[model samples]
Target: MQSFAKPRALEPLRPLAVHLPSMSYVDVKMRWKKDASFDAVPVLSRARDLRPLVSLARLLSPSPTPVSVVSKLRSSLETPDRRVTSFLRRFPAAFVESVGPEHNLPWFRLPDAAVHLLREERDVFAAGRADVTGRLRRLVLMCPRRRLPLRVAQGMLWHLGIPEDYFKDPDHDIAQDGFRILTSGDGVTCQDDDGRELGLIGDGKGKEMPLSVLQLNAMRKFGSVAKVPVPLFQSKGLRLKRKIQDWLEGFQRLPYVSPYEDFSHINPGSDVSDKRAVGVLHELLSLFVTCSAERRRLLCLRKHLGLPQKFHLVFERHPHVFYLLLKEKTCYVVLKEAYMAGGDTAIEEHPMLKVRKKYIELMEQSQEIIRCRRNRKPIELQSMVSCSGDIEDCTEILS
Candidate 1:
């Protein structure tokens, strides 16, 4: 067994080197990066989590899709009627409305800037399709059946730079051998290597993918080894074995503070301590599921993370790094860079996303059944029998 040395003393907590109150948000963000802890979290956008934002953009992409049409489209994703209305009201600058072709119906269209944003997303995806295909193949390989749910899969399309319309085309086969659709009493699911049923997807119970050993430790390690006070400089000569040893040495150095250590002693009124707390919090968040944490949930951990009770202010002070989404009556703090557009894009495929896509696709089929129920009035017995047959045939195709 390898022997480990005792951990070194933790560095004394100090106020930020400079006052952030006088600095702009951008400057504060830039200065925060100078600290070794900047962006320690691996933030990634959850398209499903941000469905209201994404579905709205897609609904209004090409032209003014009718408000009714947009509602129907959003319904496929299980977006609530109130959420749709509220989302529109909250972001008035991104949307505008006009009369539909029928003259009485109102149609919604994205503003010029929003339209341009969609175009940029399209252009980026087109350029990166090959890159996405390779990553997607690897994702399927890791899963048991190479199958995933459509609900979860849809979110990843945006993250992987895959065209939203790609699946609509029967002829386009990027990973034909690795991906497919399955229909069951529950709903439509995607399969790769076709016959394998890995039991990765099921009722709400199986929705969460199994957590990896690496991910589980990422956040926990921060509180264990982040406060060493080695000279804040990189060594040019260190290589492989020595480099690993250096890392071990760094963690064991004097001035240690586990991210989990209590922060009640930190001077909350001082700008410096506040900044350090913010950086630590941000890094802690990176390890969270979905790269997001509910505001209330974070508040509950205030003592454990050494955060102030009014920790919400830290997000406001760094608008460029964090996005606060107020939806479903809960406030969610999302890392801005984890979303689609950023200096480092989400080109990497995620297993959790691959699994969820199937569920979303199943939801799509359920929505179709709902639409059929709502649209069908009284029909003759013979016609009703024929309609049921058609539904069965359609289900097979969707599967």
Candidate 2:
């Protein structure tokens, strides 16, 4: 024992390499199906070119405005002065063109019908001021800082049912209601004062929150919120492959996350994070009057909503909940449940949409005027030709 060699130093123990199962699911690429009903939503175009007519009408509400002034107000190069003038001319029922006496330039004004429609729209907006403010507040609350830039808010004016004039003096009534406008070097930002979070599920003050489309369907089908809601396909024959369907079933089984809840704890590439992204998008479209928006417009809110860099892929991945329409080279994302079975009518039509329909009806008159003018041209030319022939014959006889 005295002669025993010194015990060799124990080999350093190595930690085991634990391999965690990947929670990420493969994004199965599904073919997009065109739903005529969703495509029928008004102002589906990317540029929403027709909507500018409303703004033009408002600009001329005080008096006839020159094209030069309208051109200057155009912020996007997509809608040039020529396009604006042409669009205004197409809607003769809404816009009236006249020559200015002093400048001798074209001036556009809204007709009586359009003026009445605008007044009706104002009444609708006034009556729904509380609702509008609620939507704007929800949007601000969705942001990480509980604030939204003035430009971002303005970009979503149409979707949020906010009036353009609201920005000019936001501090008046809009800001007085649990909101404040702050100016910094970055620019103006609208911040929430109360700072309460909102969600599609759960309760507040013992009152249950409004359920989402999927939640409502789940309640209707399973008679409980715990079960997975079956997706409503765009068409009758539309069906997902076995693997895709299985993946969707698993996805639906994940605990639903409220869009307004904090997402910091969620793993970025996991299924839960994907579910939260879908929730955020669903909540966003639900707030829109049309329950749809241009894909590009939603891109601006990606960072504000805590979405991933490739967030738009959610729309394509979950085709059952959302429908992506590529019309006029513009991508529009539509909520499937918002529309009726036929997709022609909305389940819950906004009050503003009724007035908008009236404006659209007025706009149709312009096409009729063009058709009449086109049809009358042939008769007028024929009459002129006959008259010229008679004159020539009379001259020959006189000679």
Candidate 3:
């Protein structure tokens, strides 16, 4: 695997000599730069990492026997760290541990209440498959590469409302052979003018499907990036706004520069060119930050947008427009205007938000189950569970 930066950084500065931490050897790297940020990067609390494990546990809950969680997780999880057992141990209430009868190794299984949440999740999935598929189809179409990594799809499962079983379902896989879709993993290439991979031909099973005129038009439009406008309200100085407008207008008059085009000839440090590059990045980020925050390091764009190692510095320079939260050792670059009063993202009451509310409910249900099992008394989770208020009143119904 290629080396990339971890979303979170090591905290309190652990010594490398005294003793190596168990989790330290894990592949926590993201597909982005590894350098420490100019600003302090925050470490994610243990709870944050545990959430992924919860989803993983649910995926594995159907097994009749307590299967070795590590062996099963290798395929399911992006990175099965050495700290897997340690992380699982942290959540005894959520997952039950036992020795595998056949393998004589430790195994984990979800409790009954957690399974109930899983059942509810399945119901939600059944109800939302059409919407999720539509969203996924649109996402695939929007991708400059026309294919996304399976790992990325899995990571966005909650927000996308994509079922965990999507890959298993031939109808749902984005790269179904009959659909003339090429999966990202396939070593196929479409040579652009600069010899960069730009388009997908199809699955290797049959004759290459040619791109339509409309599809070609879409590709052209995708390359045509818009300019970022300066915030007029924030600029108290009228002269400043006028200066920005003039600068932007002048910048627009220059020949359109495709990000994929070679920038090696251009001096990267030149203020005029650098300013243009910054605006390009801002415009690119605006497209994705429509729902929530995006990673400041932007690993996904590194190759696609031809960004440099220190590209994050651009967002850092424009602090007013981009708020960089050094959370989870990764910089979450959020648009300043996208946030509401309570720090929640402004997604306009999207269905994805509603799905996430169910996730919150799952966590609550799991906790309540643990509480009841331990205390031997009924544990009420009505107050703990949340609803997006789009469907129904969770408080009244649950109460």
Candidate that scores best on lDDT? 2
Q: Residue 156 of model 3: what lDDT?
A: 49
Residue-level lDDT tens digits of model 3 in 9-122: 757966776664221211111122222332222111122343466466655664534444355564455433555665555455456777877857777877654565556556
lDDT of 1 by residue, 139-189 (tens): 333333444445444444544446556666675554442455455533544
Ten contiguous residues minimizing lDDT sum, candidate 2: 390-399
> Per-prediction count of colliding residue pairs?
27, 0, 6
User: Could you tell me every candidate's TM-score relative to the true structure?
Assistant: 0.37, 0.77, 0.50
Pairs of colliding residues, candidate 3? 7-328, 7-329, 7-330, 8-328, 8-329, 9-329
Please report, as a residue range, the 10-residue window in candidate 1 with the lowest summed lDDT.
Answer: 380-389
The models' CA-based lDDT, in order, is 0.45, 0.66, 0.45
Q: What C-alpha root-mean-square deviation, in Å, does candidate 2 show against the real structure?
A: 10.3
- What's model 2's TM-score? 0.77
The pairs that clash in candidate 2 are none
**Could you give candidate 2's per-residue lDDT for residues 174-258 as a string of tens digits?**
5444555455422433243333222212112243334554565567667877764435554645877888878887887787766
238: Cα error in model 1, Å: 32
> Model 2 segments beyond 4 Å from truth?
1-18, 43-47, 76-82, 102-104, 170-172, 184-231, 341-348, 377-399
